[model samples]
Every structure is written in C-alpha cells, then in structure tokens.
Target: MNSRTPRPPHGSSRAGPPPRPGRRTFGAVCAAVGALVLAAPGCGVLSPGSNGQTSDDITVTSTMIREGEAIPARFTCKGEGVSPPLRWSGLPDETESLAIIVDDPESVGGAAVHWVLYGLDPENPELPEGTVPQNGKQGQNSKEQAAYDPPCPSGDTAHEFRFTVYALKADIALPDGAPLDQALGAVASNTLARGRLIATGGR
Candidate 1:
C-alpha cells in the first residue's frame, strides 16, 4: 500500500496554460496516461488553480477496510457481496466529474475488474455502503454484469484489490453498461488527477 503523497513543495509560480488537447481516441490516451507517457508535454499535467497551486489529491477512504489488509467476508462473495462505503476528499477545485473503479490486477487471465462506475459529480464525493450514485452509470465488469462483483480469488493466496478514483476535467459521456476498456478510455482521456485505495482479500 502506498502512503499519502506529501504536498507539492512550496514556491508558487504562474499557473501553466491549459494542457494542449490531444487528437487521439480515449482508449489510446488512457493507455498513455496509465503508462505515464502523458501523450505529449502539454497534454499531461492539468492546469493549476488561479493561485498557481494544484488542489489536494482526491483521496478515497473506507470504514470497511484498511490498506493492504484483509477485507471482511461480509463485503465479499462469501458474504453479502455489498459494495463498501467510500468517502473522498481533497478533490481538485476545478474538477467537473469523477470515476471509480475496483479491480484485481493479479488475476490469472489478466486484470479482473470487479466494479466499473462512472459519472459521479464532483460536488459530492461519497458513496454509501451497498449503494451506487443515483446519476452514475455502471459498466460491465469481467463477469459481464453491471454491478459490484465481490473479490473471490482462488485458493489461499491473498489478493490485492484496488479502489481507484479519477478526477476529470469534464464529465464523460458513456452508455449504460459499457465495457471495462471503454470506461477506462473515457476516464483516461479527461483525467486531471487520480487517487487510489487498496485492500487485500482472500477466501
């Protein structure tokens, strides 16, 4: 599990110009961002605030589990399989929308997505336990269903499950029950900043 990032060192300067827009599709853009290639110089980091300062990172926290720790059965397939309560803070002031994804990257075939959620308003950054945002759209995960899929790793090997939140410069347009890759692409193209929370789960 990673610790909170310390604030960017002091010494304010003029905020840079808005990042140059890219002409690529959302999927390619997302792959670049995910790889930290950033497409091009001006297309990477988002614009800072009027004060030439970036807002705090959008962090995700949960009362359900701690970083790198085992998740209780009540939140997994062996139990109720409910989505955990999540709260976010330090959102960039200019954030227009947000996206959330929960997945396991160590699955046998590849990254196994457990949840694909999007369209959360920046105004409110909390998702209550066992619920989804009213206006948000749910995407289909590896299970081919548009809902929360509990972490159910095979055997006794503990698995790491990540809950990531992406702050976007604008609201993303997505159809209901979109596929995982499509959801990620929309998120990557407009991502301003991203935060994450991780936990472990095992049968």
Candidate 2:
C-alpha cells in the first residue's frame, strides 16, 4: 500500500462529472435573451405614450367652455357668432409649425371639412377665443368658404365639430385657398406631429 491512507467510503457518493464549459456558455446566452425580452415593447421599458397620444389624451380646453362646459346656442346660429376660445398642451417638443382644421364629422357624405389653417405659430399655446380674421387665408371647406362655419345640424341631434391642429416640420407650400385634399396631403408629407379638440352643438 502506498504511504497515503484513504478515508472511509460514504454511501453512494461517487464524484459527479466536472462542470461543462458549454453549459456555462448556454447559461450566458439565456441571460442575454432574457434581458432582450424584458427590454422589448409593452415591457414597460419605454416611456408611456412615447409613440404618440390619442386626441382624447391631450388636454384641450377653451376659455369659453370649461372642461365639461356646454356651448351656448347663440354661437350656433347665423348671428353674433364668436369663435370659441381654445387652449392646448402636451405637444411634442420637436414641433416646427402648427395647422388648425375644424370640421363637422357628422356630415351625410363622409366627414365634412369646416376650417383649414396651416402656418400658425406652434409656440403659441392657444387660439384667442373668436373667429380667426376673415381676411386671413381660407382653406377650401365643404361650403368652399375659408372661415369658421358654425354647425347648423338639423333635428335635435348634437353635431361634433373637431378642431385638429397639425404640427409640421415645414410650412405647407399651397397658397391661401388650397383644396382640402391638397392641404391634407401636404400635412401628411410634412407633419412632425398633431393635436386635436372637439366641441358639440345642436339646434
């Protein structure tokens, strides 16, 4: 026998195989995959609404009408019309220019276009309550007028007028009185972002 002495054998305690290098590598790969999975979309890794928020999420208010304010009937008729005041926030910081379009979506044939205005200052947070200057350039509305046409919905049903504000990367090239389709097309090609507000009136 050699000089060294072996210890007493334990019950079925044979030596296991040495740790495998491949297993360690596989574990590392699995860890990386897990990290990527946790960082993907809907994983709460990104900011909420970073892609963009819906019109409902924006804070759109009018000085004339409170958050739940009811619109007056006088503004709905042909006489003594005052454009409602509007205020907005939460616009994307990259906005370069602003456009405003107001339309009656309840029109019988498709959504009707009411007011189309591009090239407003995006820096300005509000449109002073009232009709924009008549002399100001008018985009082609459904009636072919370039001004705010108050809703004169028939029957007792309330009609919603949607005011959409587009944030553009550059000023639209069309002249004052451009057609609705053309203006919208220009916006589609150049818009950096947009916002909207809605108010309802019935007669």
| Best by the lDDT measure | 1
Top TM-score prediction, candidate number: 1
C-alpha positional error of residue 41 in candidate 1 after TM-score superposition, expressed in Å: 24
Give residue 57's error in model 1 in angstroms: 2.1
Write the residue-wise lDDT of candidate 1 on 80-147 in tens digits: 88888787887776678788878775545444667778887666657777776666778766666677
Please, what are the lDDT tens digits per residue for candidate 2 over residues 125-185?
Answer: 6776554432224465555555555556556665666666666666677777775556655
What are the models' TM-scores?
0.71, 0.62
lDDT, candidate 1, equals 0.64
Report the C-alpha displacement of residue 113, candidate 1, in angstroms. Answer: 0.8
lDDT of 2: 0.51
